[model samples]
Target: MNVKSGSAFFLKVIAILIGIAVLAVCIYWLPAAARRDAIERPGDYSLYPLLVCAYGVCITFSVVLYQVFKLLTNIEKNNAFSELSLHSLKLIKKCAFAVIFFILLAIVYLKVLTQFTGDDPAGPISLGLMGILATSVVAAFMDVLQKPLKNVLDEQLKND
Candidate 1:
């Protein structure tokens, strides 16, 4: 597909919207659930670590989103589809790194929870972490596919 086409732009916009929704869920629902569970269980601050993990993921996702948007802006400024495709691939690479980091962080949090002796109340966080990991995997594949597209664009641009 043409990276500079309207469809690509539309997909990017959709991704941004999904990111926003995830952020909103993290900010509102995640905290309230953690707080409630903490209060109900009293003496079990286990949720704290999970909450922290969620926040960390949220922060990283925000950064990823910011970087992606910046990349999009830069791509839009380029005259050739090849240049834009390359920028998008780079952004996806960064996003994959961020996702992997967050997944590792989540795993660490889960391990810590298991060691501390308490309820595994961070189900939402764990689930969200998995979602991010899956997303990153897909994004990484896209970046890989973009390599050939970038080459094609480069050749086309050279001819022009």
Candidate 2:
């Protein structure tokens, strides 16, 4: 296979693997962590808030991954420089923002709850911060890419 198509193939594989990994985390890790939280707090909190946060995260990240897949498809079709790919990048950035929003909301929720429970919020807060940072970086990357793509499209329009 050619270098371009080969790269797209590899990226597709990577994206699928990432989806699987996230599914596993949602199925396994989240439940275990929730159980631990319940055991530690006994009756201080319900899992519903955490579940909502997880649901938001999963939804947004899934959109990001779907956008990545669409972007790769555009690359394979030689349309990576076109409006469709730009739209995909825009959507991915939006998804990143959604993820950040959810993380911040969850952090705030945890902070308020911990204040009442007298529990240390450090652990979850730190984790949420890291998630926020990561999501912000993804949004920034999409912003940078979209700008170049817009510039290219503008230049092409002028030439045409």
Name the TM-score of candidate 2.
Answer: 0.88
Model-by-model lDDT, in order?
0.71, 0.90
* Model 2 worst lDDT run, 10 consecutive residues: 43-52
1-160: candidate 2 lDDT, tens digit per residue:
8999999999999999999988888889888888898889898566669788897899688888888999999999999899999999999999998999899999998988888879999998999999899888889999999999999999999999
What are the TM-scores, per candidate, against the unseen true structure? 0.62, 0.88
- In candidate 1 the C-alpha lDDT for residue 88 amounts to 61
* Model 2 lDDT, residue 119, Cα: 94
